[model samples]
Target: MKKISLILSLIFLSIGLLGCQQSGKEEELNKEISKSTQEITDKPTIIGEIVQIEGERFLVENKTEKLPDGRPDAVWFSTDEMESLKVGLIVSVWTNAIEDSYPQQANAKKIEINEY
Candidate 1:
């Protein structure tokens, strides 16, 4: 009877240790999932100077950022406030989605022209 009890206790202890390890792995996975979710939900903002304009869309050059081709990172944004925007003006644009292409493109959700 004693031998049987010892065997049962060892089995239970092994299971308990495995459960704790699995719990830790699950916690780590949850943290990673939360981090990625936040990144997906956050809207990206671009701050740069307008370099070109075509109708309601304009190209912005971010001097601080660069593309793999050694050109300054640029984005073309379509906005209804084109009347208030012009080349050489610095602006901040909030966007929901950006297309992956040379001179990335996005529709501006909000635009703020820098006066100073």
Candidate 2:
């Protein structure tokens, strides 16, 4: 009877330890997920020259960095913030990412003209 009780206690202790470990892992996973979500939703800024403007969208050629594809980086902006923007004009754009697009498009939150 004593041996049976010891075995049962061991089994329960093992299960309790496993449950605690699993909950800790889950909490760590939740924290990592929250951090990743924050990064994805965070706004980013870009400084570049206007390559083209079609309606309210501006095609910008990034001056500060090249894209991962080894090509000069470009981004599209959607806003009425700067209506007088002309091609080759330098500007700084603040934007939020648009989901599910290649070359990564963003909706312009603000635009500043760096050149007159």
Candidate 3:
């Protein structure tokens, strides 16, 4: 009877340890998911001078930040807003991420010209 009880106790302890480890992994996954969600929600609004404008797409030199590679951060904008844009113009652009692209492109939702 004592041997049976010992085996049962070991089995229960093993299950408990497994459950704790699984819960720890789940919590870590949840934290990662939360961080990603926050990043998506916190997309930065870019304020920059228009460097180039080609048809419906334009490139802006972001004065407020730099890219990870130490290049002056440049954002690409695609919108009807191009009608009012000119090279050297300072503007604020509201944007959203383009899915599945390297150096990520943004779709400009609105553009407001800032008076110098």
Best candidate, lDDT-wise? 1
* TM-scores of all candidate predictions against the true structure: 0.60, 0.55, 0.55
lDDT for each residue of candidate 3 in 66-109, tens digit (9 for 90 to 100):
87878776778788756678999998877544534433477776
Candidate models: Cα lDDT each: 0.85, 0.77, 0.77
Question: Which 10-residue span in candidate 3 carries the lowest summed lDDT?
Answer: 35-44
Candidate 2 error regions (>4 Å): 1-44
TM-score between model 1 and native? 0.60
Q: Candidate 2 on 1-116: residue-level lDDT in tens?
A: 99999999999999999999999999999988775454322334777899888887888887768868777777788886666788999988775445445445777777778855
* lDDT: worst 10-residue window of model 2: 35-44
What is the clash count of model 3?
0
**Model 1 lDDT tens row, 15-97:** 99999999999999998887544432343478889999999899998889887789898899998888888889998887766
Span of ten consecutive residues with least summed lDDT in model 1: 35-44
